[model samples]
Target: MSGQVRNTTKIVFIGAGSAAFGVSFFQDLFATDELAGSTLTLVDTDPAALDRMAGLARVLNAATDRNLVIEHTTDRRAALDGAGFVINSVAIDRNRLWQLDFEIPKKHGVRHTLGENGGPGGLFFTLRTLPLIFDFARDVAELCPDALFINFSNPESRIVLALAKHTDVKVLGLCHGIFLARWFVCQILGRAEAEVEVAGAGLNHFQWLTHVREAATGRDLYPELRTREKAHDPAFTPLTRRLFHSFGLWPTCSDDHMGEYLPYGWEGGEHGFDFAGDDKNREYLKTLIDDVASGAKPVPDDWLKPSWGERAVAVIGGVLHNRHRYIESGIVCNRGAIPNLPPDLAVEVPLLVDAGGVHPVSLGPLPDAIAKLLHVQASVQQLAVEAAVHASKEIALQALLIDPVITSTDAAVALLDELWEINRPFIRPCV
Candidate 1:
């Protein structure tokens, strides 16, 4: 379990072309000494994009002197054979489709905060994403049955729930939202991030911080956190601040993400996602990758360092070498992890990862009022998955109607039809 130990496990990266994921992922791989001799297969539908990342990976491999066996392919099935780990972060036509996911719902009079993880946006995301996810699960089940499937897709709770409900793949969904929670606490408590410990359990975008303490002293910091929060600037994280007061448990993530699950989420803002900004960032990263890979620019020192915040590679190392470390957060099936929530629901909670695999840490029960709110989302997410799996128009409509963000049945019908038309080509009946 020492950092000096090396393993030759075959690790497959599906959707390796993603500029956002590829850079941090490769950095993490290069930084892990135990995985130095491992086989890394990069798979993507776009050959050119895959080649670019493969080039970047090779550059990092040589620079770090890790001796990793690097491979790339557009065909995922070819890369799946005998793989011990599969990391997936695929998005279908990301920005263009996401723009519609935001605009079309607003056009129907559905007021939402963020269109990616909850509200009408979340329903459409589940619809557009699940068909492909099911296909990936089927492939993993057949080709590499024992490989740990690490998912980094959005609509995290819904995706994890769908995969857990329908597939036999050993799956785990990882997100950086918990770090957002830790950051918020550190900013408020005037403590460094490493000095504060925070844990939460709920749906992905809507987790509540049930445990917040000073890491050094094991002292509860929530009492002081509440005191400082009341006098703090009202404009900063206003919606989350309000929710913490109302629910008596601080909501994790930020205003936009936390706002997704509430009807009054528009109080945060309705400006929607900045796709242009994202596009610009992606292009810049692509250029940087090409420069490093083609030797036009030197391999950046950051590329040789570990990922900024991602935990997937750390989980892979833990499972590979039996390092029983506590992972801050992971998306997993509830299964009584939270006593009040449905066992089938996917809840974000602290995890214990080691050779036995990822285990969800029980935080007992949340407050009754908070549980009521999450229960509604749990039902909505369940219906959303069912709608996607069957491609059932009726079920999809039911999901929209029951959602708190949708006020009008007529609008729900209109939004569903319009969004469905856009995503129809990608959605297929798993049953």
Candidate 2:
């Protein structure tokens, strides 16, 4: 389970001001013995938010048995010094800008249901955020060149692509989509989630389950999965069923998210997530900030139990402890992982993470049909990366026009105009 365990390791969180993610990540750090005694550096833009989360991290560290070193700063460079793993989940006005990421495309006559990771919205989201992300990556490249640069931001594939292409840092974009594939198989088979082994590959939100087998017997379960979907498909996953019916392989993630890539996504799909809960969660974090700053509410004792998913934490542990582990799916440059897709394009595929670092595992080739569907997205994402880094409106327009959803040239121009004027402040001349 171990290759090289560092006597002292540093894990820095880029967006520790995010309450839900910060809280859950704190829980994960406490739960992992592999990272015990390592220092945690928290970075964020908001000072008061930093003050609040710093208090919570201290409270959690005191309650835990591990000798966790906790520090907070708005200066990312100050935090990146000698970091082993740089975990990033920073968002620029998440709920508010996410609303813009969704609605702006719809205004341009794009029939998109979910704009988070597909359509023009995803492109714009990548454009706005990568500037900030690349800034962090540049510092990491200079300060902690060997650190595993991990991103938990949205439009995971595009972000990884931008960093991969623009920065010297090799990045890995981790998403929960890979786990959903296993859950989908288990649900179809009427088995416990732990009983199903699934292999999936595609874009981040648009991955497909290529293999499903029973864990104990190594029996193929795709036939039975098809049979169940034919008899009674779940309404909750209509888009997945639709793609599976056409392409003959179940896709990972939910209908709304999968709907983002398809042209007819708006017919019976959602445009974006109901961030009402997210909004409430942000407000709750605000309250917690006040409570922590005012010394009323302390860090919850139950976080010691750590009930959140272990995707990011596992990668953190794998590198820091040299515990080579197989991650179900992580986004990285193709490097021939999928022969059908471009070698330079970032794709979500399984990988073995260890002392050698996060290596992209070969997943053979996707069916021509699936490859064709993802290729368009790969192009749009690449163009978006170019547009963001170079500040090219022409490139951004080309990306939107190339996007399957925004086919009309006139519409693309009009849409970009509106989106540009609206997000002018944040986008800041980054076309």
Candidate 3:
């Protein structure tokens, strides 16, 4: 892999302070041999957080012998110049704000499963997030126009659509949901995850698996998957099982994410993300980082191992080496890629990556029944993107009213008024 790259590249991470993503990203980056000697810049708003990640990166860099030229700063503009790749995972006040996003809607009688990626909550997230991301893209366009923008942000579909419609930053959204789905399929079949192959495409979290087969023989496995899924525990992934039964296409991801799109999502769970558990995990990770970075503990072997689901480093390596690699899944604009969906809508599908760019592999047309379900989301997403880009509260209201998860116009109005105020400090025109 190192032999394939002819020149060193500069890579930038816009929100590199995150405990989970920062460490995981460094792990993948250090494990890739081809990326050695590349200049890696970490940018974040929080100076202390940035310093901690920098310390960890230094420890990893020394341990792995990757010879990476590491840099850290709070100023993204200073870091963006001459960068070949920009990876962003910025979530403004992530947990605190998301809690409000869920609670406010529920208080207004809107029962949502996970408010991060759908419903009125998703609308507000779009409002708050799109402006900041567009600002980052704007800087990239001015400083390093050729850099590939890889995003790991939530409200994945909305962020991709907004960037595609309003900016020219050459963006792609990545998520591990598809891998989770593959694991789910393998679980039902009682086989190792490596033994089965699954392909799905739709919205980011709400993708439908169209092909399920044995990787060894390319044998169709969906029929047997259905049989085993029925006989298996009814308690596991109940929403996904029901959807697979009704639509004949298995949905990837679990209940919380898939439930975001439907009005009946409360059937999965009315409670939102587990902030308490997440807080605990965040603290544990911080301690681990402190210990490892300060030489109080030895580096974990797993930290130096290659990650299976993360595709950012794989993409960088592919583009640098001009390797036309087949990526399992990525988010990009749908220009007849799905045929039935709107041409401008952003859809998640397989990708082919090379020096030219990231190209969305056309899944052709989805099943009619499935397409029907996605059509509504397409409209809602379109409106939400418009609302966010223009900073139009009226359009935001319309987006919420049209959403399937938003049952009552009155509740939509109340939820919007409350959430819009809560996110007012972050909301702005992306243009």
> Which portions of model 3 miss their true places by more than 4 Å?
1-5
For candidate 3, the TM-score is 0.98
> Candidate 2 local accuracy as lDDT?
0.80
Residue-level lDDT of model 3, residues 209-328, one tens digit each, is: 889889999999998998888899888888888889899998878888889999887787787899989999999998999999999999899999877688899889889888899888
| lDDT for residue 35 in candidate 1, whole number 0-100 | 85
Model with the higher lDDT, candidate 1 or 2: 1
Candidate 3 residue-wise lDDT at 69: 97
Which pairs clash in model 2? 113-271, 114-271
Please give, for residues 1-431, the per-residue lDDT of candidate 2 as tens digits: 47854566888898888888777787887776777788989988898778778887787777777778888999889899999889999887777777876876676667887678888878778777877887788889899999888899888888888777767886999887767767766777788987888888888888888889888899999888878767675674676777888989888787777778877777547546778987887897779756764668765566776644448788877865678899888999887998999988989998898878898888789999999989878888888888888767788888888888886788788878877676666564322
Candidate 2 Cα errors over 4 Å, as ranges: 1-6, 285-302, 428-431
Candidate 1 weakest ten by summed lDDT: 1-10
Candidate rank order under TM-score:
3, 1, 2
The C-alpha TM-scores of every prediction are 0.97, 0.93, 0.98
lDDT of 3 at 47: 95
Candidate 1 per-residue lDDT over residues 125-230, each given as its tens digit: 9998999988888889999999999999888889899989988888899998888878987888888998988889988878899989989999999999999987
